[model samples]
Structure formats: C-alpha cells, structure tokens
Target: MTQGFSPTSTRRGTLAGIAAGAATLAMPRIARAQSEIIRIGFPTPLTGPFAAEAKDQVKSAELAVKQINDKGGVAGRKVELLVRDDKLNAGEAATRTLELIEKDKVHAIVGALSSAVQLAVNEVTRARGVIYVSISQSDTINEVKDFSRFTFHEALNPHMTTAAVAKHTFKKGSKIAYLVADYAYGHEMLRGFKRAQEALGATSVGEILHPFGAADYSTFMPRLRSMRPDILCICNFGRDQANAIKQAVDFGMNRQARIVVPVLLHNQRLAIGPEAFDGVVGGANYYWGLEDTIPSAKAFNDAFKAAHDGAYPTDYGAYGYTGVYSLLLAMQKAGGTETDKVIAALEELKYDVAKGPQHYRKCDHQSVQSVLVLESKKKGEMKNPADLFKVLATEPASEDILRTCKELGFPA
Candidate 1:
C-alpha cells in the first residue's frame, strides 16, 4: 500500500524538504531540481467488489505509461503515475483525489471505475483546476451544472450505451422490465431504457431498484418472474452485476425472458460463468474480439497481452489505457502540461487507440466512440478460456445516440 496523506504529514514533509534542500546546496542545481518528470494521478477502487476490474485498469494504465516512457516521453520529460485506492466510496474518492492534487501535485488525473466516484473526484479536480479524464459511465456528469472546462469523459455515457443496446435488443410491442441498482449509474441507464422502449413501441411491465452491493437477488426474482416481461434489462455494475445475473438465471428468469445488460463487462462475465450469461446481449465500450477487424484493437491487444502474461484486456480495462494515452498525446501536441493548451489539444485531436477512431465532443466533453453489441457464447462454443463474447454489431460513433447539449441544460 502507498503512504496515506494527512495534513500533519504534509507539514512534516515540508520541514523535511527544507533539511534536504540544505543538504543538497553543495550539489549541482540541475541535479537538485526535480522538474523533469510529469506525474498523473490514478484513483480507483482497488480494494472493493470492483477489485478485479480495478486491477486490470491499473495494469493497462501502467502499460500506457511504459509505452510513452519508452518513446522518450512527451517533449523529453519522464512521466510518473501516482496511484491511490478510492475504496469505491464517493467521499473516499474525493479525499484521495484531494491528496493527489494538494500533496502529490499531479498534473492530471485519469482513472475512475464508478459513476459516483468519478463525479466526486471531478468535483475536487474542478475546484483545483486540474485536468481530469473520467473513464467511468454516468449521464449526470455531462449536465452543464456538473461539468467543467477541465473535465473530459473518455467512457461511454448511459445515453449512448443504452440506446445501442435497446435498439438491437428491444422490438415492437416487447414487454420490458428493469432491475436497476438504485444509484446514479442505474437511474441514468433506466432513463435511457425508458426512452428507447417508448420509441420502439415497447411496454414497461416492471422496474425494481436494488441496493448497490446486493449479495442475494432471490427476493427480487419473484417479482421479476411474475412480471413475465419478454426483455429483462439488468442495470447494475461490478460484482453487483455478477451476483444479480447469477441469481436471476438460477431462478429460471432467463428461461422466460431475454436477459440484457446495458454495459456488459468482461470481468463480470468471467465471474458469472458461461452457463449464466449464455445468449445474453449487451453493449460494451471495448471487447478484445474486435482485434480481428480493427488494427488499433490488435495493436492494443498485442501490447497488453505481452505486458500482462498473455491475458487480454477487459471491457472497462481498455478505458484506463485509452484515457491516459489520449491525455499524454494531447500534452505532446500542446508541447507542455499547461491545462488550457492540453484541453484545447484534446478538444481538436482525433485518433484511433483501441476501438477505432474517437474524439471528445466539444459541448459536453464526452468521448464520441463506437459501442459494441456483444452476445455471450455458450460453454460448448468456447475456444479458449478468455474467448467469451461474439460481436454481433458495432454501433458506429455518432451524435444520434447521444443526448443533445440543449437537453442537458446547456445554453443555446
């Protein structure tokens, strides 16, 4: 574990700095100065239900850092990363982010796994004028009230992800039900599902809100089974998603309804097993299966596998690489770590890193990228332990799936 930051320790560090300065006075000024390194903060839930996903995120991010440093870094300066565990709590996320900024002096931040935790970290970064690229999904963060010039969302929002999933999964007159997580993430996804259901002439039969870390979903299964909807959308994430789908299948819910996940995670799929997720349709930000078609995908997969003992990157894990790589590339284009210049470069820059071409939208700073429609393969169809999903469709990146800036309360 890294050292925990405290106000008293910060004061002690200051005194220690003075003594070190006195000791280093006889040394060369160039050797004494430590301004040749760039530090970016990475805060994620490294010790909670999302630990598996978080571990993959850190590994990919470390790969990005290593790749950049191998290329002599941006403008000849070495890059450093400051990692902290947020524990999946909003308040804890905010506090750790504060330490990253006030204590460690990170130039930018580029890691978050949960919607609420990202928003909490954003608040701290915004107040301090630090550049933050959120790699988590949340529609509320795009609102004008919550967004800032320094904030950029590299992850797909609920609006874009759910629209793609709903279009392909729902049909006319289909009976739909939602098992929501009762948080910002689940609420936003539920809202998107409702909009799509209405547009497609579908009927909403039932909607149930469960707590974030629900261990057992047997109680909710009865109500969902009674509804008998043709489509059941599981609107939870992380370990909650794994347990929900497992219990739902055990209750014979999938026998009657088509199970759909708005954001299908590779880590969650491995946890739920093939038997539980077979025939499950959902949307994903990135899937290793795309390496067959996209050159960028192949490049990322090859590099990540070489670095991580031949293991592939998960759906959300790719965000960690994309988010940090894009930020450093922007800094290189801007020729410095100046916040305004980096933001400008990011706004105008476009590149294909992992999932084909993508760029940040100017209005809300949301990453405009493709959403992959994936179906979990049956156990009999598996070729390898990592080969899980088959890409059914690729919803090309466009503004059609995104909510208009006007609808997000932005000025016309």
Candidate 2:
C-alpha cells in the first residue's frame, strides 16, 4: 500500500474539523435552495495506499472551491464540496459514491485516484445520472458506451502515455520487460504499452506482475534482471512504484537497464531521489517546469508554490485542481446542474488547462492533451532539484488510438 500522508496529528485533526464544520454549515442551505449553492462530491482515497495523492487532492479541491466561491461561483451560486474517503478500494469507493449521490445528493463528483475505484464508482454514478469526472488513467472509464449520460474524463488515458513513451523513449527492436501492478489500471497500462512496443518493432522479453501493496520486490527483481531487457516499463503508482524502483536499484538493475515508467509524478521523484531517477524516461500529464511553455501553467505553479511552501505539483494535485475547475466550467456552460447537459458540455470541452490546449475527444471522452515525455537529468545538469526532467517530444494526437478503443468494444 502507498504510505498515508504524515501530516502532524494536530494539523490533520484541524483540517478534518474544518471540513466537517464547513459541510455542516453548508449542506442544509444547499438542500433547501438548490439555486443558491452547487454541491460537488470529491470521492478519493484519503486514508489508504494512495493517501499522499489524496491529501494533495483535498488541498487542491479546497483551493479550487475557495477560488470559485470567492469569484461568486457558477451561475451566481456558491460551490460547496463534499468529500469522502474511499480507502482506495473498489467496493469501498462504490459504497461511498452511492452515499454521496443518493444520500448527500451531490450534483457532480470528481475523484478516485486509481482507475479501479473510478470504474466501480462509475457503475453507481452512471446508473443514477450523476455527472462524474474521472481523473484516473484507465481507458475503460471513458470508453464505456452505456455511461455517456453521466461520465467524462479530464486526464490522459494509459494509451496516451504508453504511446508517447514508446515513440520517444524506445529504440527500434529494443527488448522490453514489464513490472506491473495486478489491477485494472496497471493491466490497461501494460496492454497499451505492449501494443505500442510491438508497433515500434520492439520485443517483449518477459513480464512480472506484483500484487498491489507488496512490501518487498526482491523476488521480482531477479527475474527481471535475468531477462536483461534494454528497457523496463513500470506501471504502478505511489509507494509501490517507489519501492520497485528502489529495490531494483539495490539489486543493481539500474546500472544495467533503463527504466520506462508509464506514469511518473513529482511525488515519485521525491520518494526515489535524483540518483535513482537519473536517466529514467517516463510520461506525465503536467510538469511544473513546462510552465514556461504555457502562461496559465506558470500562474498555477506560482499559486501552488506560494500556498504549499514551494511544494511541487504532482499528477494528483493537477487532477484535483483541474477536475474541480473543469466541472465548474461545465456547470456554467450547461446553465444548470442537469446531468445530461453537463456531461455533453464536458464531452465537447476544449480548454486550456495548466498543460496546453486540451480537448476531450468525443469518441472516447479521453483528453487529447499534452503528455510530457521526460528524462530525469542528473543534479549537475540541473539549475535546481525541480529541474529534474528534460522534455523529449510531444506525441501527436492519433485517431488510430481512439479507433482502437472502439474496435475493442468501447463506445465510439
């Protein structure tokens, strides 16, 4: 399991108090006067393996709501966020999602870090016509045809990340081995990378699946080392990802092989440190250093740094911030909280986020946005620790990838 955020006990308690107090004060009014307030549900893993990411999401969501409310939130209504912790489990996520939709009566929901949780929650939200904005990378969330009435996604899917990594990081005929988590999201990432690798004329040497939250990776490292593939693709997140990379380094695998991570985040960089990350290639939805390329990105980075004492924005934070803002935009565009209208607006979205201009491709509802292919540079090559990555190439939007989703029985 990923480690939970280690905020001081007092601080954690205080934040919980604030959230509870705010919810208590806001819910009654929201229920009585629907036009006066818009309630948004945030169902995320706030206490489990992915807790660090969830903590960041909470902060980002709070910041977004505060900003929106300060500006006289959507359609002259104040925005209220109701948060639930899913413990990063699929069943738990589904239960919490029902509570938020049926009990709390949220107009929309934004969260669930893992694709598995998102998929489970989608089952509930879609059936009831509640708008859901997924931040996870699993392609299945947006590909399901029956859920179009309520589901939309704002993050790049595994296929987008895998295709970018395959095109920019691998050499022709390169031998590859995969160390992936045994979960829906990890499996999707592996499938995407496998297709991309084969398309690039690369050979799949072998694969090892690690159960999520496996503490020690000693058993898996030796098999991967034995394969001696030119590249090792990782498809796990949070502490599991850090542990795998660290264990691989301890087993001297880094000295012999290059790593190709399908999803890399700033928190992972902090966990693994620069020495272990050097020369690694991976894909990210957004990186702070890319701020120079987009002006809105610079403003977001500056605001986040100021608020969090220079904390680097991770994929979780970006998703949380963008998800709330995106939903608000959709609500404004739709003129009200009508589920179908909000979802249609979201599907047709073409906005400039912290990353460049992004469009939610109508076919799969996947964000056709920039996915950064980064090489972890050494300290000597950096102007600062945060300058750890050098952009390689931005993969062009491919209709073929979207077509593949439809071919695989997903909604076109």
Candidate 3:
C-alpha cells in the first residue's frame, strides 16, 4: 500500500545475473564449486486482483536478494532470483513453478500470494523435493497430507492467526457471521473461525460464500443484515477485502455490527481508507510501525526505505523478505544447497529478520512467530499517512497458539 519498488521487465530478467555469472565464470574448479548460481523461484499473482500485493512481494524479495548479494551471498555462491507471474490461477501457478524448477533450474522457491495458488505450487515443489518457503497462509499446507520434509511455512496459518484474533475480539455468547471467499483460503479461515467460536462459546449466525474477486456484495449484504450478528468476520484478502468493507459500510452494517478481518493488509486499509476501516480489528504478521520498538524491524524498514524512496513495507510484503532471507540463511548454514542438508539447516535455524526471533517447527515446518493484534486507526488519530494501525497486543510466538503436530495428523 505504501510507495514501493516495482521492477521493470528488463531489470527483473537480469537480476543477479551479472554477479552470479562473473562469480562463477572467473573461478577455477575448486573456486567455482562454491560459486555456482543459486536460483530461487518466486511465483505470485502479478496480473490479477492481487497485483498490488504481488508487486510488493517481488520488491521485498528483490531487496532480500540485494542485501544477501551485498554480503557476497551464501558461501560465495550468488543468488539469481527468478520471478514468474502465476496470474493467481492454480493451473497457471503449477505451470510457472514447473518452468522455474525444470527450465530455470531454481534450487528453491519462496513466494505465493494466495492459499490455493500456494497449494498448487507446493505440489510441484514437493514432487521435485525442492525446498519451498511459503509466504501464504493455509492450515492444510501444515497438515501431513500436503506437507513434506522440504515444505516450510513462513506465514502464520489460519488457525494460529484466527485463534489469537478470537481471544482478543470475541466475547462470551457473541453472535458472529462470516463473509467468506468461496475457495481454499475462505474455507480454511471459516474452519478456524468455527473452532474459535466453539472455544470462546460464541454462536455463529450465518455464513455466505462469495467468489474470490467478486466486485459486488449487494446480494450478500441484505442476507448478512438479516442475520444481525454482533460481529461480522470477513474472511478474504486483497481488493476483495477492500470492496466488501466499503460495501458493508455503505449498507450501514458497520453501524450495527463490529467488523473483523482475519488478515489485515496495509494496502487494503489504504484502499478502504480510515473511515471505512476504522474500528476494524485483525491479525498482522508484520507492521512497519513496529520499527519504533523492534531493532530488526528498524533495520528492515530503513533498508527498504533507502531502496524505495522512503516507502514502508507492507505486512504481506514482509513475508516475501522473510521467506527468501531465511531460506538463504539456511543454505548458508548448510554450507551448500543440497535439499536434505538445507532442510536440516532450516529446521534448526533461528532468525530475527523483519520481525522478532522465529524458527520453523520440525513436525510441520510452520514458522513459530508472534501475531500482532492491530486495530485500524481513525482519521483523527493519524500521525502520518502511513500510521494506519494501532497495535493493541503482541501475541508471543508459542506452540499453544498453533495446532499441535498430532492435530495435523503427524505421528508421535
């Protein structure tokens, strides 16, 4: 949502090429062995409704590569970040991922914007035994059926995020309704919301499933109003979230029930503005405002700003950086890019990057990290244009917030 960098086609294609080529070509056999090109595949929706978020993701990932290359890269090997536009379609995502791995020979993968798209891309990565650091949210990805030894989830799953949100926002006997996108992401969020509802003794009024990128919420608005829920949870992302919130406000629903988003995006808040987004509560993986109190946040924020004309990174955009940077660190720790060695290294990795200290859970490869409970700021509360969220609480990274390994169908 903030002013961020977008790569031109020419620049995108040539990224890290010269450095990697020179580093490898100039070396003798012994020297060149450690200087081989390490290509990282990045697949995200760059042409659809999620374009804005994808652009941010690309910029942040590029920043990670730039920072790493500046330090001479992993064990003298330069990284060539090969990005592809998945167009937000599962089939297209799979196709692009295959090309990256088979054609481009990328050693690993780091980006996916949507739940379904991530799942599709995961299939390709998993089949090839390539390490995938998913930046998208999905509970199913952590489950045994979809998870593999090489799979690492850098983003918070639906259960972990929603449970924290419910603890903070839900009251005993509260009536809730859901406006879910009709897909894997929405279904997963709905499942988590229901679990939260049961845990908190909150009652569900009704649920309405809408298309992922639906432009109109008119039909669903009237039915939602009839439900008369005390809290309305809109489980969607990107422009869908912005449009739904705007339409809800126009329908005077905001006056009746509190609105909660499962994932609050900085760009979405900017699109909806403070007026429509005001008083909304949601969970965030990272917020640039944390730079004030967190040293790592300050580092990431300063570097991003220095590169992109003083623009702060978006919450989702932080995932892109964390995913790539963490993977590269793991490769460095492993001393090479062998799949098994890298996997072992990632499991043992403890990183403090865009956020606080975090590591992947061995059982499911889910990143153990904090979830910030953020409330949208009112227009009167704005200190600056970018000051949109007021952090209410920081839910510390704990196994308690996450689904247990046993719950994810993992054996003891």
Candidate 4:
C-alpha cells in the first residue's frame, strides 16, 4: 500500500544552524560519528496458537540478518533486529507497531504471519509514514486506498495460490465445495478459489463458513458428504485446518471427494500428518526440495536445516527470510530509510529469491511469483519423510488474475 503526504520542515533555524555547523566540523569523521546501526522491527505471534509458525519466521529472520551483516552489512550499516509479539491479535499488532516506530525508532518493519495482524500493522505504519513490508499471505494488505508509499507485500496472495491449485486440481465441469474459516483470510481464500473454479467452468456445489479455532467439524463434514462434490476445498489455517482435514477423513468424505488445500503451510501439514493428507493437492510459494534448482534457495535450505536439525522451513520461514532481505534490497536502492523512495524501489524490484522469479507489481504492490501446485504422495513414495510432494504443474502467470484483484477493490 502507498500513501501521499505533504513535505514539511519543522527544524528550528538556530538548532538547524548549530547542527549544520557541527556536521561541517564532523564531516571528515561523519562515517565514524554516525551510528552504523540499521534497526528492523519484527512484529509477530511469538506466543499463542501460531507460536510454532512464528518461531520459524523468527529463526529465518535471524539467519537472514546474520548473513547480511556477515557480508559487510548493508552499505556499511550493521543491521539490528527488534522482535515484538503481537499475540495473533490485530489490536496488539497495531500497538506494538507504534512502539517500534515511535519508541524503538526502527528504520523498517517486517510483520506477523496472520493477515489480520499484517493489515493492522500496515494501517498504523502507513499513517505514521513508516516503511512496512508484509510477509503474510493476505491480498487485502495490498489494497489500501492511497497505496501507502511505505508498504510492500513480499508474500504471494491467495489469488495466485488459489488459482494455481484450482487450475491444477479442477477439470472442466468439476464440482467443488468449500469449508472456509469465518475470518478475513478464509473469505479471501474462498473468493480466490471460487473465481478460479468459475473461470474453469466448474460448479461450486456448497459452501460453509465456521468460526476460527472451532473444535468439532462434525457438522461441516456431513454437509460436505451430502454435497459429495468432486473436490472439497479447505480454506482454514492452523488447528482449524488440521481438524477440518481430519474430520473429512474420519467422516469418509476423503474417500468420496478429493481434498484441495488453497494454502497449507508446513506446520499445518505436520499437524494433520501424512495419513490425513495423503493424495491431497495443495499450493505453496516455496518448498524446501525446490532449493536444489536454485543456489540461493539451496543455501537457505541448508542453513535453515543446519540450524533446526533438518526441520523443513515452512512458508512463514521462507516468506520472513525473503521478505526482510527484499526490503533491505529496496532500502539499498532507495539509498536511505525514506519511505516513498523505498516503496518506489520495492515496486520496481524483480529478483530471483528462493521461490523463483518474483516481482513486486507496481500496480497493486502484490508480489508476482511462481506458485507450486503439489500433490501429496504416500509415505512409501517419498525419498525422505520431508520429501512428501510431487510437483503437479507450474501455473502460468496471467494479468487476468491480477485484473480481477482490482474488482475485488484493490488498486489497479
């Protein structure tokens, strides 16, 4: 999101004069006198249900910061990371973001895994003219009215991921049912899936929205079984996601209907386990196995595995790592910490990160990247326990997907 502002100079003349005189005197020693620190604020759910996911993000960010600083830092400035927990709440996210910007005075901020937290933090950061790069997978984060000059989304939106999965799993005339969480993220994911399904001439046979963190999906499962669609799309996250898939299996819906997950992260995959997810089709921005094809990705995966005892890095980790580095690259291009310049640089960016070719679309500030459509293979078919997927297809990029995003109230 981008924002506009009027430039103002409020420095008192005498103070300005003194400062200028001091700067003149210190010109030769400016490099030594100036603080070499560039602080980055990370606001995420360090506690609560999302703790495991958040921990991966924190680890990834820490690794990235360490790598950057080791490579002579960014333009001779040592990077400093300040982490704050949002506790998975938007209100707390906003409060913590303000603290980071005003009290901590961070140069830029990377944020929480939940879209709600990202949206809340973006609002606060935009209003205050601070740079915020979102690592969350919420399309709404990029739909701000004025396109806040400081905000950028480094993660792939639901539109891209959903469309990719739908295209891979749904054939013409395919019947589908959606079991979505009753929240902004779930709604957005459903919208993306519905759009893609409709474009392929598929029918949405049924739809159900349950509250987040709901324990029992028994009611929803029967509804799904009754519909008996060719495919059942699950657009929930964390425990809700795990429960929905598990119930689908327990209710025998899995035997009748193929399961499709619009956005399944690593933790959720582990939560549901392979037994429940076997033969499932899902979408992801990056998978650790893809690292072999790309050097940077290979390095990242190796380092991440080394640090975490071979645990696979999830979307949260990949996004957090790449998101922070991307923002740092933009800051470098902008030549300073100024918000507008940084946003402009971000919009113009195109780089091959771990996820493959990724560009921050100038029109909507949405990251354009290749999305993987993966099918869950049985445990026996796996080369290793972590190598559980078979690549189905790489979705073709189209302007139409992004064009539809505009109708969804996002900026063109």
Candidate 5:
C-alpha cells in the first residue's frame, strides 16, 4: 500500500447507561395514542468489541427520529425507536429481532455491527416480514441465503468498500498481504480485496486472520515482516484492529509496507493516535470533514457536537443517520407505514443526506451513495484531534461495483 492509497480508522461502560437511555430514548417516547407512534427496532452490539461505533449509530438514529418528530413526525405519526443490545452474538441478534418484531410490534429494524449478527437478524426479520434497513457493510447480509425483499442497505457492502479503496491502492503498489479477522465479515473482506489486487494485476503475498479480541498481534507482525508485501490490507475490527495498528507502528512496519484499513472510524483515530496510524489509507462511509463538501453535513456535525459534549461524527453515525432519515422520507412518501407501500417508495427514494444525494438501487436495495477514500493525515498535518483524515476523493457508487441481487443469485 502506498501512503496515499485511499479513504479511510470504542469504549465500554457508562456504555450500558448510554445504551439503556438511548433505548428508552430522548426522541420523545412521550405519551401519545398507541396508534400515533411508528416503531422501528434498533438492534446493536452495545457491550462488546463493537460497542463504541454501534452506540454512535443507535444514538444518531435517535437524533434523526427526534429531528423527524420535531418536524411533526413521519406521516404525521411520531417515530419511536425500540432498542435492543445484541451483544455481538448471532443468536442474541436473532432473539432481539424476534422480540422487537413479534413482541414490541415494531414496523422495521436496523441491524447490529457484526455480519454474523446481521445474518441472524436478517433471517428473523425476513421470515417475520418486518422491514430491515441496514448500514452493515458486509455483502452477505443480503446474500442469497438470507436476503429478503423487505431488506434494504444504506451502506456500501464489503466488496464495494474494499474496491473503493483498492482502486486507489492499485495506483500505489502491488504484492499485497491481508490481515483479517476470522468470521463472515472478514472472509468477505479478504475475498473482495483479493479480487481487487488480482484485477489490478497485483499478486497476493499471503493472508492471515487473527482471532477476534486477540490482545497481542505478536505473532502476525513478524510473518508480515517476512512476507515483505508492499501493502497490508487489514480487515480486523474493534480492539483487534487498534492493537494491530499500534503494534505495526511500534515495529516500524510502515517502513516495510503501507497499511490499508478498510472501514476506518473516528473513534479508532482517537484510540490509537495519529502517529500510530500515520500514512494509512482507509475506506470509510462518512467523515466529519465532509461537512465541507455537503452543506447539511456541517449541520449534522454541529448538532452532534452540541448533543454530545462537543464530540464529532463518525462514519457509523453518518450512515445510521442517513439510513433513518431516508426511511422516514420513504414512509412519508408512501403515505402510510404499510410494508409494501413503504418498500415501493424506498425503492425509488432520493434524499439529500450528510453525503449529498442518495438513492436506492432497486434491484439489490443497496444505496447508491458516495464512499470516502481517505488518507490519514500525519500528526503534523492534523489541525486538531478530529481532523484525522485528509479526503482523497468521495467516489460515486457505480453499477459496475455494486452487484445486483440477480448476480448474487438472489430472487428478483
């Protein structure tokens, strides 16, 4: 990986309080006629490796609902978000979705961060016929085994995210090695990057997957040193990623190869510091600095800061906000919350989000929006703590990259 490859990097308790409060919520769950509220289920990993980003997502969704309700709600019905903690487990995600749908009577659901959790949630929501709108980047969330007409994704899939950054990587160097986790999302991430490297006439040096939550990457680094690939395409998550990047920095691995962290977030920058992540390229869903490109993006950052003690927006929050915001617009357009009507409206829904104009590609229900390819600014280049990434380009989604349901062997 070249230093200029592309786009693109959690907490714990006090965590539970944030989760519980967001569940009951600040978006007015105030007393109203039962029929006056439109319920959307939000299931997320609130207490694991995924906590920091997932909470940002769920709270931002709450903020969107508050904004919608403040403007007289979706379709004149106040939106009520029903929250559940999936605990980063697939079985837990399934049970949470079931409870949200069958017991809480929510009309739709937004899934958790983990692909395995998302697969479970998709299974439940599809069989039960509740609307599922996701920002989960894993391609298989809507794969043939689990896809349903009721589901729509607002974020780029793993393939799209990887390719967005990979195109830029091809311009930098060849002979790539992958450092990934060992799960569904990781497998998809590896597969996507592999295809990109091969397509760009690059040769893969090797691939290594560290178990989730591995405290030390002591073993992986020396092997990366030995392989001597020009690029290190990382597909690990949470603390695992932070640990890997930190160790790489300490070991001066960047002298050996460039780093590419697919799906970087703001919190990661804070956790590991700029020196550690220096010269890395990342594929990301949103960046706070996008406020410069998209006017309303500034509005979101301003509001998010005011609400959270001057905190900044992450890609997770950006996608979650856009997803909920568009869902509300689709409902309003449909004139009712009836499933078929809303689905029809969403298939053509166009809304200006933090990332300019966004519309759903009907065949696969994936949002056709921009994915940011960014390079991490060096410690000296940083204007402040929040100014982590210097935007390379906000690449537009192309039909060539986003595979359709039919191509993925899903029912049309």
Candidate 6:
C-alpha cells in the first residue's frame, strides 16, 4: 500500500515553471480586486458527473492559495481564489472563463476537471492572454490545431495514459474492445488505444461510444460477449466510468475479459467500490502516498491532510495544488502579473511541488511529468482507504511515451 515512485529510477528534483497552454458556474464576478490582493479564477464542476473529483480539486487549490498568503503573499499581494461552477457544460465553462477575466480580472486560472470544460475555457483564456493550467487529460487540447500559448496542460492525457498501461492491457490477448465516452476526450483516448493496439499486434474486436452521462451499460454487456475480447477497456471517467463497470459486473462480464481503464481517478475508484474494481488495473498521474517519496509532495499533503480531516490527496488534488502553487511562483518570479513576464518566468520555473520533477515544454505549454501504472489490490488486502493500488511501473517523463512538443506538431 505504501507505493513509492522509485525515486532512483523515476528521477527527482523540484518541479519548475511550465508556460503551458491552459473552468465554472454563475458566480458573480467580484466587482473589484483590492490592490493588496491577487485574484485567481477557479472554474470547475460542482454539480455534475465530475463533481466528486472537482471537490478534491477545489480543496487542494484553496490549500495552496492559503499557503501562499500565509508566506507573506506573492510580491506583497495576498492571493485569493474566486470559484465558480461550470456544471460540466462547455458553454457555461466558457462564459465563466470570460467572466473571471473580463470582470473579476483574475490574474490566471487553475482547476478544470472535464476535457470539454478545459477546452472551452482554453479558447477564452487564450484569446484574453490569461494563463490557464488544465487538470483534465485530453491530448487534443494540446494538438497543434487547438494548442494555445496561454494554456499549459498539467494533467496526463490519454496518450500519456496509454504509455503507462497499453502493453499490459494487450498482454493477455489480441482481440480488444472498448466502451468509450462519446466526446473529444473519448476520441483522443480511442486514437491512443488504436495506436498502441496496432503496435502490439493486437486486433480490435469492436468498440462502443456512449453518451457522457450514460447510466446504463447493460445494453453493451449482452453484445460484448460475442466480441470475445481479451481486454475490455473502458475509456471514461467519473460517474460514467463507475456505472459502466458496475453494470458490466452485473452482466458477469468481469469473468469474460480483463477490464482495463486508461486512467483511473481516486474518486472514480471510491465510487466504483472495491467489489467492482477488486482486480482492476490501470494508470494514474498521482496519489497522496507518493508524497512519502517526494519531499515537495509531502509538503503539500502534510498541510492538506492536517487541515482536511486527514483525507489523502488525489491526482486532481495534486493538479489543483501545483497549478495554483506554480502560478504563485511565476508571479513572484515575474514580480508582477503582466502576461508576458509571468509566461517567461513559467517557461523556466521549477519547484518541488509534487512528485518527480515537472516542467513545461516552452514549445507546447505541456507539463512533462511521470505516468504511473497501478493495479487495485483486493479490498481485504487494502491497509487503508487511500491504498487502492500497488504501483507496478513508474515511467519517467523523459521517456518517449510522451511525445515531444515538436512531435505533437507544436511550432518551434
């Protein structure tokens, strides 16, 4: 249960600035920002499919901001977070992003849970020249077609997730079937899976793209048996993922094919319960226990747990903390909140904010960090609620699994 990042192999150091490319609801834009305070916008789902994860995101973000303020604020200006709920609606997300800028005049943004919300907010943040660090993992956001200078991708995307577990997923057999969420993220996930399957000499049996908020997956279970898949990969997250796995178990599909999730969230695991995911194996970007391996991670977690009822951190929580923490660093380095100066500082910034050394590729505004493969142990084997999985492999960001900015078609 004490999963370390194998510091020797994964590499370690303080993470630094990532001028990455880059959330919310209807919270009224604060009419004024006091000269003594710096406001940062946090737009994310508070009442939607990703709500559980978003709560963790907000908690970590708030903690980071408070720490900054406690340490005499950034450049003598207190840090304040203005939050809004986007309801996981892209239109609402974009609107909130604009409000955070045009009205609240937030220096930057941190915390977006869904790819759709992240993408939509990115469009607005970029156009406004505001920095946005995303917590969602959709490779398309970094695609040259949609890449933005003002945005930094902080979360591991589908491509990165694939690098962590595709080989193991295909190890059992060649006939692969997938039930993906029908959206931009699902499309990117499918692309990553297809690429990996082809490279591993695996054949696709069949695939299904269900709606985002789908609750019933019983429809697919009856038909899935004919595919005779060696692996049934579920490319979804939050409630959609939990529901699909639950029904798949009900249909007795768990005994038929190995269930593989591209990237599993802490909240999703809790929602799916131990019974549904007792033997599930997948990848993750971060875990609270990893703080034990990385000093910076421990710094964040110690304070977070002490104040938040001893609850551990999730990857989303890590993203929220790092996103806000790094921005504060950039602002301090820049000595002001001007867009150009902050961006320059972020391009070279590093801090021990989380596990391993994280940095942003100046070319694409994508954070380079490690991706971890994990397998959930049986419930009886778990020593604590947080010890959901055993770390199987830790792939350093230096590996070729995550494409270089140039390879991703980012202009030099």
What TM-scores do the predictions have? 0.91, 0.88, 0.92, 0.88, 0.89, 0.89
Q: Candidate 2: what lDDT?
A: 0.77
Query: Over 4 Å off in model 2, which ranges?
Result: 1-34, 396-401, 404-412
Q: Which residue pairs of candidate 1 clash?
A: none
lDDT of candidate 5 over 176-203, digit per residue (tens): 8888999877888898888777778888
- Which candidate model has the greater lDDT, 4 or 6? 6
Question: Per-residue lDDT for 352-400 in model 1, tens only?
Answer: 8899999998888989999999999999898999999999888998877
lDDT of 6 by residue, 153-188 (tens): 878888878857887667634788899999977878
How does each model score on lDDT?
A: 0.86, 0.77, 0.87, 0.77, 0.78, 0.78
CA RMSD (A), model 3? 8.3
Q: What C-alpha lDDT does candidate 6 achieve relative to the native structure?
A: 0.78
* Model 5 ranges off by over 4 Å: 1-34, 171-173, 404-406, 410-412
Of the pair 1 and 5, which is ahead by TM-score? 1
CA lDDT of 249 in candidate 1? 93
Clashes (candidate 2):
2
Query: Candidate 5 at 267: error in angstroms?
Result: 0.8
True lDDT of residue 2, candidate 1: 11
Model 4 has a clash total of: 8
Point out the higher-scoring one by TM-score: 2 or 5: 5
Task: Kindly report which residue stretches of model 1 are placed more than 4 angstroms away from their true locations once superposed.
Answer: 1-35
Local accuracy of candidate 2 as per-residue lDDT tens digits, 1-412? 0011122345333433433444445444333454657889898998967888888888877777887788778888899999899999877887787678657878888899998788777666654456788887877665543334467777778887898888887788899989999998789999999888888899889989999988799999889989989888888988888888878888888887788899776777776788888788888877788787788788778878878889767667888888888888878888778766887888777677567677666765666677778888887888876777888876654455453665646544
* lDDT computed for candidate 4: 0.77
